[model samples]
Target chain A: MSVSSQDIPTAAISRLVIYLRILEALEAAEISRTSSSDLAERAQVTAFQVRKDLAYFGRFGTRGMGYTVPLLKRELMRVLGLNRTWNVVIMGMGRLGQAVANYPGASDYQFGYVGLFDIDPELVGREIRGLKVQHADELKGFVQTRPVDLGFLAVPPEHAQAAAQTLVSAGIRGILNFAPTMIQPRLIPGSSEVESEWKAVSVENVDFLAGMKRLAFYTLNPHLRPSELKPSELSSTELEA
Target chain B: MSVSSQDIPTAAISRLVIYLRILEALEAAEISRTSSSDLAERAQVTAFQVRKDLAYFGRFGTRGMGYTVPLLKRELMRVLGLNRTWNVVIMGMGRLGQAVANYPGASDYQFGYVGLFDIDPELVGREIRGLKVQHADELKGFVQTRPVDLGFLAVPPEHAQAAAQTLVSAGIRGILNFAPTMIQPRLIPGSSEVESEWKAVSVENVDFLAGMKRLAFYTLNPHLRPSELKPSELSSTELEA
Candidate 1:
């Protein structure tokens, strides 16, 4: 039941979550077991890669029998560290932050929106989706007593770094930054900076830019068919160009 | 300068856009040429990986000279299809949609928010951030004349699928879906269906979930140590678990 650092790849871990989601759907449809190929097809990956990825953790499938839906789901939940609930704090109660707080998916993932924080005095003490908006000054005190392991940064780009610094100083470890700005902060003295990791989950902006690039590429070369473009070739060419 | 479908991995291309943003910041700081090592450091990636990724696009770097600041920036812009403006429409301009509309990063990426749409009569004829909210019935007409390639969906889960179908039917080729729901729609008869092509980019609630998972893993197993967690191992473990 104990997982070491060598246990899994981050990418594979993401896919496992996706696979679990697919399995949940299948289970709801009353399907009992599924082969790697079936899972890969539904999850938009290759069967060989799926098998290889699964093998890295431990064998979860038989040669021909595939995997039991319920057992695999339980195992995935355990491996993903999802068996326990995660306390989440939304650092900004702006429209984006409020949207995130009200996001139904948060409940599905068991991410309890423990508190909401913002600096605007007019907005302070207000309630958003039932979560009271607390002042930013209370972050450290709140973290000391309640102890949040994860924080979401939905503040504007200018405030992102400061917000992250506050969270780090407040003893929060993992941050899902949505500010669409780069945040670089020096680790506090005596803190475990080595183990700390920050993920910049740029939202619709990245996707918008990506979609624009694809459209631009397509528009410029109208004669080229979409089928002619290969993902591998794109990777190689982009690197070599 | 033509890029065929075989030229890049979609994931890598997405990362390239991210790198472009970082490079822009470096350029703004008046940094001239940047070596792969420097770029990697700034982007939180490896030097060799940066070189490898850039090499796939083309030999933009000199053997030891690194990449020229302005020239590389221009090239990245061209590669990411950011050379031209992209008109965007947001459906369901509720809290999430409004957040996206006012997101400063969207404007930086040249995504002009052309309009917002909702079925609610109260919202119709109102303007949020200068983009007038229109009836959902106007979507098809607006798309036909204005010809928007991208659309953002911020509708509730129950309405997501129908909205997506409407957008696809209206000939909007690219979609940025923010609805936290699963959407599976059968291709309309006589409509194009490209297997490798993804016209709709589903931004699931995965980012938050991923951050939570990482935090859980890091916190619950503090003794596991960072060196033990190889990217590949994490991938495999997540898959099998």
Candidate 2:
């Protein structure tokens, strides 16, 4: 079966990433084959839910047997566009930005930090994790010379919008915003709101504060955890779990 | 309307967080009343979705009138358990932990950093944002002296489980795990598999790598974006949008 991006639910895509992690763990343990039930238990969802999620892309497992772990892992990786390395640039080299730049997981996932930018005069010209921090004004010139696939917005909330605009103007494909504020696609100078080019720029937000709020809710209501719910209940409320 | 934790969908809870953020923006702009359409536009979801999500909590709006911004925001804060301050401690005082400890947003939401812990001797006794880093072994003693509602797990993947166990043993109510690894509640000593006490410890995972992967997929297939989808199409697949 052929697959289009719209054919899959956004939650399924997030779960695919989780499924890929499970497959990686299984591979490390030298496990070759797995069933939907195995994945469901580890993913904290139902077996049928796992099958339905994978079915959106294509078929994989046998009726009585199971799925080939490595094969499914490869397919999921390919679907998520993780098979290749992504060159990244960090905007606003604050503590969070510098920490992400030095993070070991970035290299593990092939997310290379090619350039770093900061507006602070003291931070500019300083070297961090081998790459020299350049002034934010130098972003456009730096991007023209080097292809940056993803731009990380780690600036304060007040500066997030301008930083995002700079990334979009610099022709960056995607943004992983770490700011607490929401970044919207404002109308370009000569373009109508409907035809704005900024719409083409993909943005994904990462908020530890939001995660903490979820934790707070769960802490207040531990009896209602998605992972610990019954299988029948799992199917009914598994959205974004 | 009576509301149980199980009555609400996990995705709805997440949307409530988003809605709360939007309400905060409205209040900041001095807006008093706002309609579902107004919230829907900013949140990038259908107005019907906003109505349905709020319905899970209780009645808030009238037939023709909109919601009171501050009132709705206060209700959401209560539902999300964010009304009171949560005393938090940071585990694994590496760069990520230090950044989180020093992040200004922490104070904005009342996530006070009470204590900092690390395995490294060099880091121990060092100060970050007015809190001195303590050795990991002192967590039990520290918790006994003061209340620690949340624990931020910023350790590497290899050490995540041990650190998580330490947090659980210290009676931390919740954990915001920043490690890339999956932290499971293994069976505690003398407890049956199903009766493990660790299950009571709430854990929320924050993976910037997973967010980056989502960015990759969206970059590859911007045409299938959830926010840009038609209203008719949105209701069908807004499972986790």
User: Which candidate has the top score in lDDT?
Assistant: 2
TM-score, every prediction = 0.79, 0.87
Candidate 2 has an fnat equal to 0.65
Query: What lDDT score is found at residue B161 in candidate 1?
Result: 71
Per-candidate DockQ versus the true complex? 0.25, 0.49
In candidate 2, stretches whose alpha carbon ends up further than 4 angstroms from where it belongs are A5-8, A44-49, A186-195, A227-241, B1-7, B35-52, B186-195, B227-241
Steric clash count of candidate 2: 0
Model 2 score (lDDT)? 0.79
lDDT of 2 by residue, B1-241 (tens): 2467555667777789899987887788677778788788667777999999998778887767778889989988888888889999999888888778866576877888899999998999998888889999999999999888999999988889889888988888699998877665531223443335577777788878888888888888786566553323222212121
lDDT by candidate, in order shown: 0.64, 0.79
Q: Which stretches of candidate 1 lie over 4 Å from their true place?
A: A28-30, A41-45, A184-241, B37-52, B184-241
Question: Per-residue lDDT for B1-241 in model 1, tens only?
Answer: 6454464544455457667876776677676667777666555556877776776667787776777778888888876667778787888877777777877677776778887999988888888987789998999999878768577787886788778777766766556667765544322122345321334332222133444555555455554423322222211111000
**Given candidate 1, what's the lDDT at residue B24?**
78
